[model samples]
Target: MAANKILIVAEHAGGALNPSTAKCVTCARAIEDGEITVAVFATDGSSVAAQAAALQGVTQVLQIDNAANGHPLAAVLAPQIAALADGFTHVFGPSTTFGKDLMPRVAALIDTPQLSDIMAVESAHCFRRPIYAGNAIITVKVPADLKIVATVRTASFEAVADGGAASVEKRDVQVDLPTHTRFVEISAASSDRPDLQTARTVVSGGRALGSADGFRILYSLAEKLGAAVGASRAAVDAGYVPNDMQVGQTGKIISPELYIAVGISGAIQHLTGIKDARTIVAINKDAEAPIFEVADIGLVGDLFALVPELEKQLA
Candidate 1:
């Protein structure tokens, strides 16, 4: 395609830019040489726009400041993004809840197929993604005539450092606001631990943890190691942790430097989430557990006894 410019839909909340946007920029860099522009939509996006402008490879930051953008409703935001997508060959977003909900709408409005969870950039028109819950990798080539709309898997790429001096430009798009969807109060789980998607270390528990109280051990170890707390789908279904803490194919995907799985039975669904982790440590009583196959370190023992000793040793 002659148009080499790429537009990234920035992910941000509470006036701060989410780290995933920088990762999307990294993915964009893997594509052919082009100008990278990050688009921020918010009531007061100046703060997040400034952060987006600092991403190492970004060429420009487009700020769409409007009260209607305070809560990113796909119905409302997609039209604006599609409008800004003019003259750009690629439009990118992070493969996150925010991106999952937004990008498809933008693609539909622009009459193009949306590529989800792209893991690699083979070329400007070709990409790689995971299928069958990450058990298989599939490469796809987009039609040269269509503008590419894709959501990049943030875990597969590292975020670019904050060093660029990309210029910030304001855009005023005119679109009809949808009355069917409106912003409502958002209730987010508050925690002092690192974000699960971006943490360097993660300590996760499974149904074997038994109860919510059983998760306290994992929390203790996570705190000692300055890690995020994660839970398998089984643990979340068993009510051991909130759904937000789930780490699996049906939950959040993470690629931490170190992943410590305690009492997890290693379901394929769960493995998909941590497949990109640099190192995996499996702690389960069953020596034949599927997790042992992929773990860099394996310990066949009772977590109840092992976790406490680990915490004490670290202490």
Candidate 2:
């Protein structure tokens, strides 16, 4: 089986680089074991393009800068990315809401097969991914001649070290407009700190916190650890925190290096999102909490008392 070049479809926001994109590049580097070309499609692509160039594995960066492609629709960028994949062995994206929605459409548009959320890439043809809420893992293979699209699980791979310059190439691609779905106002979060799903370290609170204020100590802990604040689905459902902070099967799945679950009982749904953590520490009043099963460290005590003590010690 002859190998081919790897093409990474980078995801990003307006100006900030989605850490997941860098991780996907890392996955692409490890899997393809070939040269890499990163493609960024945005209303303006300079920022993401520059970030891509700084990553070590990237041989070249393509900025698919079409001022009309602001929304996350595949039609806007599929033709461009699929066309870009012409010379590459595989095209990859981060397994994010944006990527999950885009990869399939891009595959269909190009008359190819798409694999969503891979745990590992065995080769260009074979990849492993979790199913049944990560209760089972499945390995799949696609023929090499056919184009393959994959969504890389951000938590499963590390971003390659940043150094060396990348060739920033401008691509002249124009696809038909949607004729609908015009850009509108986007109401974003107001917090100054990094978002939970994208943060490298996350401090999550669960039901044991009792109330919103009961979990304030997590902020202190997060500040000390330079981590983002997260909440379990239970807490978010109860309005103890915003929905954006929820971490669970139905919420955002995060793969941070250090994940601190304070007062969370470790429900299977919640665990699904965080089990990928490199290190898990659970603090729950229940000594029998299910979370302890996967936690590297477990504290059977009230988070109210435990968290403040942790904050003091770490500070």
Candidate 3:
């Protein structure tokens, strides 16, 4: 097989490179004789480009600085990426909101089919992904003749360590960006907690948390451990927390070193989100909860009492 030329779209914010970009580079490295290139699109991507160049497997970095790219609207960036995909064998992005919204547009613009949520690389053209809320794994093969466009499941791959010194090239790509989609103000919940997707440790709550104020217990514990706070879909549905805090098959997928599920009954949809977590600790009164089936440590007790005690002990 010929050397694979892989292009990775870097996801960044506030002039910092998102960790998901490194995971995408790791996925590219799995291909045989692959040459990885990361593209950074921003108003000024020099700093982010430098970070992308430091990824272990990246061969080069392309910095596309344009005022239109100041904000990451898929409509504006997809045309630029498609214009740059002329010779690349594969284009990869993280299966994050940024990538999920952008990669499909890139695939459509380039006239290629996209493979989503790649969990494992079987071969250069064959990959494995989850189905039915991670209850099943399915293998998907792209035609060798077609250019592969995919979204890497960041939770399934470790971020590539930074050790390389790849060169950065500034390119002025010419493409007619769509005017239909304009950048509106982005409203996000502000918190000092670590990001749920990339946090090392996470404390999650379920419908058992009962009310929005009930999440404070997890927040206090999360603060002590420097962990992010998350919630099951049921909790989100019940207005206990915002939708962004949801962690499940329909929500954010996470792979943390330590995952503490409090008051959660461990619905399969919820379990699918944390299946990749290294260590799972379930705190629930019911010993029959399904979360215990996969938990590394199970504490069968009232989370209201156990959680406060655990937080006190961490002090």
Candidate 4:
């Protein structure tokens, strides 16, 4: 493999590059003396390719435009990515839902081990990742003789700024795609608040929110602070919100600048998602709630009273 040559698979939709793509580049830069290139697969990826080219530390962007890549089916995309894996020492993608679904298939097709949720790059072949719900950290070293495929945990690294002038190139690769799968219509939740994973401030509620209407108070407070709204799995299981709003070990992991948990008991599973947050503020009437163990600031009070007062003060 060429010294320090990395190929990053871009995550995008509707011709716009996802922010996680830039974070993947950040992880790539951590590699000793690595030159980074981004790959975009879509029906018309010109717009996404152009955006990727502007990411700092990127050497180039590879654009593969085809109707077969319209929806990013793992079965269809893995083969295409594997065909382009030659000549690159490392292949990376953001540790997002998209990456989690795509990178393992690419690794299997290329006959290499796939590293998931990589938090740090120790060297070209050595990396660090979390295990056991983030209770422990483990270092892993892959075979130096084989190609490396990795998914970077976007929350662990800051995204690189977009100011570079990396050139975009077209790549034509041929692969056999499965006929058993097809793209279907997507149903996405609409929200005016910031995206939970990328938000600077997040305010989350738990089962104590009681009902869907109770969650509206959290939303109101979130709007006042210009924050994203999240929910614990307990809240979601109770049908207070859609599953997409869940934040926990089995849900979307977030590392915001500020995380405020209201009416939450702070289970270990929920704590794993926000462990990387710069500041954690917990408000629970139960002084014995486990969330206080990790919170930088703990307020032992009723969320119903505390939230309204906090919102008024901000206003």
Candidate 5:
């Protein structure tokens, strides 16, 4: 019955706060009588910490700036996060690539059980999450005596709007960072399109796209719609697109307002990622494709032909 002292690790890049951090704050707010603190780890975290401090219901922000934190490597961050978890009852991070890589390490360091993909909070120790590629939802509970470390499913929660002016405090965490894992140069595909996770609209292709070149029309259509581009796992496995663009149970979970899936046959794995999308549009030749069962609009036709016509309509 005591107040929950929750510490949320803020995820950021390019000195800007990722929207996922605000979503995590929203998740933390659901806990009864919770006092939330956001911890920002960066080379110079003032900007990101400031953003975290402005989210509604945030009580405090801890800004930890160190030259060693120039890149967000899990090996370097987990120790520092564990060192800061002394008095906190719960530790939370967004279930993002950043958090997915870091939270488990922190859990290992702190020797606490970590729950993943928390979609709903029933109490301080109880939560709801999806299982079996999201075909089923299950409730999980952690012991009240144990410190909780978990990842928030960002797609299920709305980001808290900026209204509060919580105070930010600089904290110097003294912990030995690992030297075994070094930051090598990152090789990421650069695109001008909106971020796949946060974009309001997304257009995805599947194995039926056939080849990388076959994806050009999807990109063209995405450009016309001013939406982000995504791909099914089958498309990524077939090398028609990069794995970074893959949208499925094994890839990114997105909640775009409008999702247009072209040539995707609606495998359950792929469907799990877009279940939260507000409107789904499917275009395929097969009338029996499972995607139509969930799609708001269905077009039974050849994508190569239907897509061009759809693009022309958008034009």
Candidate 6:
């Protein structure tokens, strides 16, 4: 693997592009601002590749079209990606589920040292990242000649703005896929609400709400503000909310324009996910809850009483 140009692998599902790919492209460009190419793998990578090309700072999109790659994974997509990686200086990806699974296979396949969850690029081979559940930040570097493979933290970089007149090109690569990981039906959530991972505003509930019904405070507040719903680890562990809504060290990290924490006792783990939020608002019965330390707006009151009042006033 040679390090001459940075290559980003575009991720998608069912023909639609994932915004993380745009964010990854932005991140990669910020790191080196060098010649950048994106590879999209699918039954026909044409659509997704074109979408990648529309993003700013992208040189071109390489499409790997194959029947076997209709549904992509390491057993399938890695080979196509590996074939392209040898010609690049660096290979970057979003630290997503797909990237989490893909980078390891690529590293093993290409036999190069891979970096994960990098938050900042100090140089072509140097980066800053979080560890200890984001309790600490660490910086490290790699050799320029090494195949620098990395999974970038999405929020650390902005997504490329739309309307860039980037050009897309097609590639003819043979995708040999293994027969594994049955493709089960894809189910969309019933609610028309925005995805928590990408939403700009998030309203979270905590265990102070005694039951699942208590969690509706988030939904109500989120609806009023057109925000996404989130939950504390205690709320998820107690079955008052789904794990998808959990925001903590083990949960998804989000950097929204605003975050409202309802009844959540501030835990270091919980703070790690939401610390980057532009503004933090906390409402808890305990006036001295740790969440207040980081919250820009603090409300100490009974959530049951104050929440409905807030919904009424905002309405």
The predicted structure with the larger lDDT, 2 or 3, is 3
lDDT of 1 by residue, 220-296 (tens): 99999999999999999998889999998989999999999999989999999999999999999999999999999
lDDT scores in order: 0.94, 0.82, 0.95, 0.93, 0.94, 0.83
TM-score against truth, every candidate: 0.98, 0.92, 0.97, 0.98, 0.97, 0.93
In TM-score terms, candidate 4 sits at: 0.98
Q: Which stretches of candidate 1 lie over 4 Å from their true place?
A: 1-3
Worst 10 contiguous positions by lDDT, candidate 2: 174-183
Assess candidate 3 and give its TM-score to the true structure.
Answer: 0.97
lDDT of 4 at 267: 94
Which residue runs of candidate 3 sit more than 4 Å off their true CA positions? none
Tens digits of per-residue lDDT for model 4 on 1-315?
Answer: 438899999999988899999999999999997899999999989999999999999999999988899998989999999999898999998888899999999999899998989999999999999999999999999988989999999889999998999999998888777878988798889988999989999999999989999998899999999999999999999999999999988898999999999999999999999999999999999999999999999999989999999999988
**Residues 64-166, candidate 5, lDDT per residue (tens digit)?**
9999898999999999999999999999999999999999999998999999999999999999999998999999999889999999999999999999999
Per-residue lDDT value at 74 in model 1: 92
Native-referenced Cα lDDT, model 2: 0.82
The residue-by-residue lDDT of candidate 3 on 216-297, one tens digit each, is 9999999999999999999999998999999988899999999999999999999999999999999999999999999999
Clashing pairs in 1: none
lDDT of 3: 0.95
Residue 223 of candidate 2: its Cα lDDT? 84
Model 5 alpha-carbon drift over 4 Å, by segment = none
Candidate 6: lDDT of 179? 79
lDDT of 2 by residue, 131-210 (tens): 88888899999987887888988768877778949999888875566655555676765776667876878999987677
